[model samples]
Target: MRKSHAFLLYLALSGLCFCGLLAHGLFKKQADVEHLEAKCRLARTLQLTDMCLFTEASYTRHLSQADLHTAFQDYPMSLDHFPSGAIVPPPEIVRRTNGKVD
Candidate 1:
């Protein structure tokens, strides 16, 4: 009986710890949502208010863009595909945000 009681107590503590970490993660994710919301709003000004543009997929894609840029920057073959004088642009805030560039 005592062993079972101790096991129950351990389970309770483990559950509480898991809940605490979940809450922390959700709170941190809110900032990511807000950042993406702001970027989406900017895109909206450019008439890019498509449903996907404001969705989580777009946010995650943008988040990964910088990483992709970094990975490709080191590869000489990547730039060789584009024109010699053409400069690769920075990672976009979101897709289609550069549609109006001169």
Candidate 2:
């Protein structure tokens, strides 16, 4: 009976350890996914900003008003402010607010 109890105790401990390891792995995977997602979001924002800036710079260099108009037509600029709903918080802003960019 004592040997049987020992066996049962060992089994329970092993099960508990397995559960702990599984939880740790899941937590790690979740953290990695969140980090990658943040990086992707930052990259997207940078791409959009770069495109807008490049288009604006191109528009500024034209010698003729007609050429400027033509360029502007090809790459239209929106004068409206970015909607709050659509704006992703920049990494810097996220860092400032959360004390970590996460």
> Best by lDDT, which number?
1
Model 1 worst lDDT window (10 residues): 52-61
Per-residue alpha-carbon lDDT of candidate 2 for residues 31-81, written as tens digits (9 for 90 to 100): 899897887798797753232222233332221212323323434773323
Using all chains and alpha carbons, the TM-scores for the candidates as numbered come to 0.35, 0.34
Candidate 1 structure quality by residue, lDDT tens digits, 1-102: 699999999999999999999999999898699898887888888765333332223322343343334424546466423342133344455235545553
In candidate 1, the residue pairs with backbone N, CA or C atoms under 3 Å apart (3 or more residues apart, or in different chains) clash, namely: none
What's the lDDT for residue 73 in model 1?
51
Which structure among the candidates has the greatest TM-score?
1
Candidate 2: clashing pairs of residues: none
